[model samples]
Target: MIEEIRIDNLGVITRAHVELGPGLTVLTGETGAGKTMVLTALSLLLGGKADPATVRRGAASAAVEGRVLLPGDAPAVARAAEAGAELDDDGSLLLVRTVGAGSDGVAGRSRAYVGGRSVPQAVLADLAEALVTVHGQADQARLRSPAHQREALDAFVGEAHRDTLARYRAAWAERARVVEELDDLVARTQERAREAELLRLGLAEVERVDPQPGEDVALAEEADRLSHAEDLRAAASGAHEALAGEADASGDALAATEVVDRAKRLLEQAGGHDQALAALATRVAEAGYLLADVAAELSSYMEDLQADPLRLEAVQQRRAALAQLTRSYGSDVAQVLAWAEDAGRRLLDLDGGDQRLDDLRARVHELDEAVAALAADLTQGRTEAASRLAAAVSAELSGLAMAGAELQVTVEPAEPGPYGADRVEMLLVPHAGAPARPLGKGASGGELSRVMLAIEVTLATAPDSGAARPGTFVFDEVDAGVGGRAAIEVGRRLADVARSAQVLVVTHLAQVAAFADRHLVVTKSTADGVDVVTESDVRLVTDEARVRELARMLSGQDDSEAARTHAAELLELSTVGR
Candidate 1:
């Protein structure tokens, strides 16, 4: 429950500190006395949108701060803790919101704080789900919407039902994804066929060529050797001849072998007389042996140097074929081989398109059946809760002096959606023997407010509502079009709701205000003696002040003695049940 709220520079309210308690508190004042501004302050604290124009003139910003007490085990307490918020020494959570301008001082900007620590505005909204429930003229208008009606029903069914709805949503999302994929596959069938045909043609060409990795490079080397065979053979024969002279070389220069033999024999003859000469003779023999080995290898090279032109011609043709494959598929034979491997796998998958389509069609049928079952389950849950909620709200209507006014919550079949395949509608049966009609066309503004209030009351009073109770309820002019006895009943119902939570109401009806456990008055003050208004202030009123305020609300003039008498009597009566 909110213990107190302070508004600074919000709307006409310069600074107003409202002390709230765990019961019904009422705010009443003349029209434009800023009663609605107090509600606006609460809205800001709950993360509602901010308006820079609502900020007081010449002020840099508008601020609203609230003190809320939470049980140690409350979900909101845990949520704040997750957000790294700490409770105050008094064990109360502090929530603050500020509205200012952007850098341009034209666009509105806002900030939120929880438990004295700055947090995102979304955190405040999350906390509000557990902290406050507000109803106003706008909410009353919302009551006519089918979506709102369905939400109210779902809220009444509690957590177990929520889990069911969640299951339905999860299934619905999966089905939507599957359907999208299936649709795309079916839509592009012709395109996939065209792609498969192209891949087949490319694969067949590669298979026919059968190019091997590195085969292109080996063929090129062989062709080069074959084309220059004559030049290569001539170079080898001349080198061999220089090392080993021909046997018939009578006119040619002396062969190297004969020259080496002559040198060795001369060295050997002189070696016997000198040790240095013997060492030289040994080195000359080793050189002769190495030269002989080279001459043998050169002789074999000349014997095997024949280049087969026919083989070279075949290599050239094979290389040209491999080159054609490379130009179409890859940079080289190795890359062409890799492309074949990948295309083989892709072709297999493309050829199996019929099988894939069959599988997708089967899965679609399965999901349709599964979703239909889930939708039916959802409808069952809603139908069950709808009847209970209708009865409870109709009972509240009876207490608000709207006897014979019945609320019928109908769950009709709707197309499957994220919520479910049920269309929930709230109908109003004004009296006995009257045909039930939709609330929008049937219920007057006053009737709608009362019905919305009853729905709220029913939701709040549900067993173990937990976070759904919201700890606080604020009604802004719920009694707008109600008067006389019905106004008193509206006040009484609000007070009854306050038994389990704090309730604050902004109303102008004197009878409704009479039922407040606390009464506050918003009064506008002028800066000077002229009629130009400057600021509005909120003050708690009691005894004579409260009576006079009620009297003024009753007759538009507090000085009327007759109105005072009536105000006193109503107050005395309203205080009895407390």
Candidate 2:
């Protein structure tokens, strides 16, 4: 429930602080004294659109703030916490919205804060959805819409219908997803086939070449060795001749091994003369053995080295084949292998398109049946609830001075939709033998107001409906075309609704204002010869002050004795059972 609203620089209300509590509260004023501005401020607090033109003259910006008391575990509380808003120790939330003009003077924007934390305007809207519900002339105009009519009927049905509707919506969503997937698969049938064919061709080429992971690098090394075979052989042969001796000639030049052997023999003969010469002899013998081993390996290499043109050509051809695969698929043989692995998986998916389509089609058929069953349940619940609602509303209209009026709730068949398979509408028969007609076309403004009031009162009094209703209800000019007994009934029914929750009404009729537990008056203060800077003030009135306000509303003259007497009588009647 909204505890209070503080408005500044909004419309004709320069600065006003209004305290709200339980029971019916009414705001009354002269034609231009700005009673509607209070509702505008409340709307702003509830995330309504902000208009710069509504700002007070010369003020930089307009702002509306509200303090709402909520249950600690309420959905709004959880949502506010998700937005990083702090809650008061008393479980109260503070909401504020400020509207300011842009630098260009033509564009404007709004800022919202919840519990002192800055948040998006949409957050405020979401919180408002769970806080207050406002009814005004504009809302009555929305009664013409079929969507709104259906919503009203569903709300009247309570939680059972709501649960069924939820199930239907879930089923509808699943069906839509399945249909979308099936349509996409059918549309891309040719494309998938073409992709599969291309993958097949590429895989065949890769298999034909049969390239190994490191074949390219190993083959390149072998080709280079064959190209330089003769040079390598000549170098090895010369090194062998120098280390050992030429195989066919006498030792014209001493080889390295012969020199080392002679040195070892001299060192061995002088070993008895000095220990240093013995060590030198050991080194010379080791050098002679190393030289002989190297020469033998060189000779073997020279014998093995050979150049073959046919083998070199085969290596080149294999390299060219591998290069072709690399150019088509990747930068190298390894990358080409990776591409083949991934393409194989993709090919499998493309080839299984028909089986997937069949599965999706079967799933869609299943969801269709589920949605249809849930929608039927919803329609049946609504039909039963509609009968009780129509009867209750009809009884209320009769008491509101519309004699012998009949209200009918018609649930007609409609194409399956997200909501249900029914179109709910409200019809009214103004007199006993008359045929029922649609509400917008069949009822006067006064009748429509009373009808809405009857519905609200019935819903509020319903034992099972209280948990689903908003905490506060605002009715603006609901008594517009009503007067006398009918106006008194409107006030009485509004008070009845207030018995369970908070209700605020803006009215001009004394009959309606008299039933309020609290009365507030909006009076204009003007300067001489100028309405440009006029200010409107709102203040709570009681006792004699309340009497005078009602008198003025009744006769446009607070000083008239007759109007004052009638206002007093009306007040006395309003308080009979309070």
TM-score of each: 0.81, 0.88
Candidate 1: tens digits of C-alpha lDDT, residues 330-399: 9999999999999889889888888888988888888788778878887898888888888988999898
In terms of TM-score, how similar is model 1 to the real structure? 0.81
* Local error of candidate 1 at residue 234 (angstroms): 7.9
Candidate 1 Cα outliers beyond 4 Å, as residue runs: 89-91, 103-108, 116-118, 214-312, 462-467, 528-536
Model 2 root-mean-square deviation: 4.1
Local lDDT at 266 for model 1 = 98
Q: What is the lDDT of residue 474 in candidate 1?
A: 90
Best prediction by TM-score: 2
